[model samples]
Target: MFRWAIIFAVIALVVSLFGFGGVAGMSKDFAVILLVVAVILAIVGFISRGKV
Candidate 1:
């Protein structure tokens, strides 16, 4: 999931550079959402793992 976020972030950057505003904005938003989800999952995993 984190990897996918990075991929989409790169794609967003590239698209923005090429002046595709709509695509860039959407991809960037998706990348941010994925990144946030990945972080939340990681934190949850860490906390749960420590209990064992």
Candidate 2:
């Protein structure tokens, strides 16, 4: 999930550089969403790991 976020982020950068504004915006949004989800899941996993 995190890896995908990075991939999309890079893609967004590349697309933006090439002046594909719409594609860049969409990819950036997806990357941010993926990153947020990944962080939330990681936090949940960490918190649950110490369960009795």
Q: What is the lDDT of residue 18 in candidate 1?
A: 99
Model 1 compared with the native: what TM-score? 0.96
Weakest ten-residue segment in model 2 by summed lDDT: 43-52
- Candidate 2 error regions (>4 Å): none
- Measured against the true structure, the TM-scores of the candidates, in listed sequence, are 0.96, 0.97
lDDT of 2 at 17: 99
Residue pairs whose backbone atoms clash in candidate 2: none
lDDT of 1 by residue, 1-52 (tens): 9999999999999999999999999999999999999999999999999999
The per-model lDDT (C-alpha) reads 0.99, 0.98
Instruction: Residues 1-52, candidate 2: write the lDDT tens digits.
Output: 9999999999999999999999999999999999999999999999899783
Error of 1 at 27 (Å): 0.4
* Candidate 1 local lDDT, residue 36: 100
What residue pairs are clashing in model 1? none
Indicate the residue-level lDDT of 34 in model 2: 100
Number of the predicted model whose TM-score against the real structure is largest: 2
